[model samples]
Target: MNFFPNFANINECLEWVKRKDLALAKMELICQLLNHPEKKQKTIHIAGTNGKGSTVAFLTSIFQNSGLQVGTFTSPHLDDWNERIKVNGISITNHEFFLISQQIMSELEGKVQPTIFEFLTAVALYYFAEIKPVDLVIYEVGVGGKYDATNVISPLVCGITNIDYDHLNYLGNTLTDIAQKKAGIIKKDIPCFTTETKPQILSLLQKISQEKQSKLCKISPAKKFIFDSSQLITNFCLTAKKHTFNLKTKMLGQHQIKNASLAVNMVLYLQKYFPQITQSSIEKGIKEAFWPSRMELISQEPLIFLDGAHNLGGIKSLIQTLKTFFPAKKPIFLISIMKDKQVDKILNTLKKIACQIIFTEIPETRRQEISKLKHNNTAKFHKITDYSKAFFSFYSLLDNQKIGIICGSLHFTALIKREFLMNLNEKLNNFSLSNHQPV
Candidate 1:
């Protein structure tokens, strides 16, 4: 604990160790030492392979719009560590983060050495319980649900947002194995919800819920749905418990319809417990909820977009969104991927619609090597180790007829986004200066 005395040293802590059996037990011990602050707040738990972040966003917005102070915990932030914890869509300030870290360090008295995620989980729970108490807290499972550090608290309701084939090394290979691991969040008599429609997965979730004597609610998009990119919004209708909801979301892609619907259903179910949530609040929340790097449009002139479609499921969704929005155009893809992902499958999938692919490397150690990212068609592929140069090369080739997409890894896209915004700001500043001088 002395080693983690400050906010800066928090990142230096160990991320994970090989011992999976002891992870939950260790977390339980640490919570016990801190008097179990995780139990103080009303909670909702969500776990899945792809849509967890988006679902969390939708739920956070919904509760916030209802005038409830809501605390949210999510992972793998794009730019800042503070992005992992928020209340009312605002991240915890650095000073607050440091204060909580210090309190936890002093309470533990160097008896327990927790991983970075473990320590952060403790900090978030404490913040919501004591530092800035809220009406409710939402916890997004960092990985597979069963042993995830956040699983220590029993939630008012839990959800699984369409499990798929990502995190194979930790969750297992087959769909059944992955579903079981995600189902680990289900608690005794705590109802669960899911948007997964696959029959086999649904049956497994049903069985697990029944064993725990908890009702399993399945959510799906309405057959009548509309997508109008003219205003970059989707209009969909959902019916839960015979009450119909006309919903609209700015988040693109058909998959988002399912994610938003799941959030709506969860909110509807919670209305019995928290009666203040109105239909108007739900509509406003769905409209305003935004999650970055998920089919985010960075520029309109060059028609550039950034997506975090690093897995097979995510890549399929990204491809669907691209085709639906820009049917006639084949995009120039600026891509980089992690070595642990299903690289061949993702690359093969993107190649189907990509007019050309520019490969680049991010600064992360886990990034896939540029030499290994090659296709059989040499004419369609180009490799540049530097991300900035790679992006400019792709940018130079853009025109009214051609579009650009920066995708593959969230980490890579985040770096390019920062670079793009900085350059854009510089250009605007120079333009302003020249105009003023001439006048």
Candidate 2:
């Protein structure tokens, strides 16, 4: 009956990431405690080096529009904790979050230990079962696939969103090793989908798929409209065998256009098996799914933007998106990342488009040392110890004609978005009230 505190709910989860133990023991323990015999649910397990989040967003939205009750769980939340778990796009309420935390904490107190990811996965699955029994659940893997807590689900669809080096410390150093770990989601006889892949990764995936007797479908990045990011409303088209449909993405990036196709391919695959999903529903779902913080534009003056390009593949995509979207202009980057990341590679890429740069720390033990910026002379630098200071400092530099992008890590982006910018309008209203004269 004891309620968990706000700090317990937020930092408790974030702290687990630092533990760095990748074994599935904690996940299985939580599952054993909370999972009921009656609540077995089908899911779609999504894994990749990049694009899995966008893919999950697209698929989740599509399933929701298909008129099927849908549950979705994604990680590295942006702006809010509730953003990680949703039923038909409705985030779990604050009271519900506390209640679930109480239950989860009770179950894990001493009898079983659970990592933050495992604990949250338990809460999400339990919530999905109790609140609304979803016809489909789409889960984005927190890290690698094999040991990922979400991997336990019997996925109706498994997607590999293109493999690359990420979480190398745990997953492995080689691309083949990483691909193998990700391909772990391709369970026995489950249909799998992938984006256009490299030769080595594709071979690894094919071997795994064949071993499991699962059919693998490689999604060719269909030529959509030539993306003109200069346009306010960026547009594209995907031509399929039966029909060609014009598509407009709420999210920016050519990578997102490819992600939309990956979602489309998965939805089409889902329909072939589910039968109830119609073409109209598919279109509606893709168009409606909204994933924030990836190439998200916060304000125009001094042009504030944020993205979680923590890895090389994601950084490449982000750079490409920035180039396409901004065209001739350059953007100043306010960036920080985790200690474990390849900072050299990331900085090398940033130097290409970074008009100027500022160094900062994220609110975590794993945040990269701000002193690392001392070596880079290609751009200006400042070390901001806390996020509030970073935000105010970055805002001050906005010249009204230039742009500022916050990048490098998802965790950093999430904190900046939630703490500084999430409710700017509401805060401004309060400030106005204290200053205004009686009317």
TM-score for every candidate vs. truth?
0.90, 0.84
lDDT of 2: 0.76
Give the alpha carbon lDDT tens digit for every residue of 1-439 in model 1. Answer: 2322243453443332233345587888888888889888999999999999999999999998999999999988889999999999899999999999999999887688989999999999999999989999999999999989999988999999998998889989999999998998998989899999999999999999988899999887776667775787888888887878888888888889889988999999999878999989998999999999888878878788888889999989988887886787778888998988898898888888888888889888889987776554367877778776676667766777877888888888888888664586574454453333210
Residue 134 error, candidate 2, Å? 1.4
For this target, which candidate reaches the highest lDDT against the unseen true structure? 1
**After superposing candidate 1, which stretches have Cα over 4 Å from the reference?**
1-21, 374-377, 425-439
Q: Ten consecutive residues with minimal summed lDDT in candidate 1?
A: 430-439
Best by TM-score: 1
Residue-wise C-alpha lDDT for candidate 2, range 1-439, written one tens digit per residue: 2122245676686676554334764565566677541247878888988888888888877777777788889888766788889888888898888898898788778777777787788888888766667787888999889888877678778888888778889999998888878888888888898884688788888888999999998877655456554544457777654657677776778888788888887777777667877778777776676777788878765577888888888888888877877775667778888878877788777777776767678768888887665444433645666656666656656675567788878878877777767786674464453453311
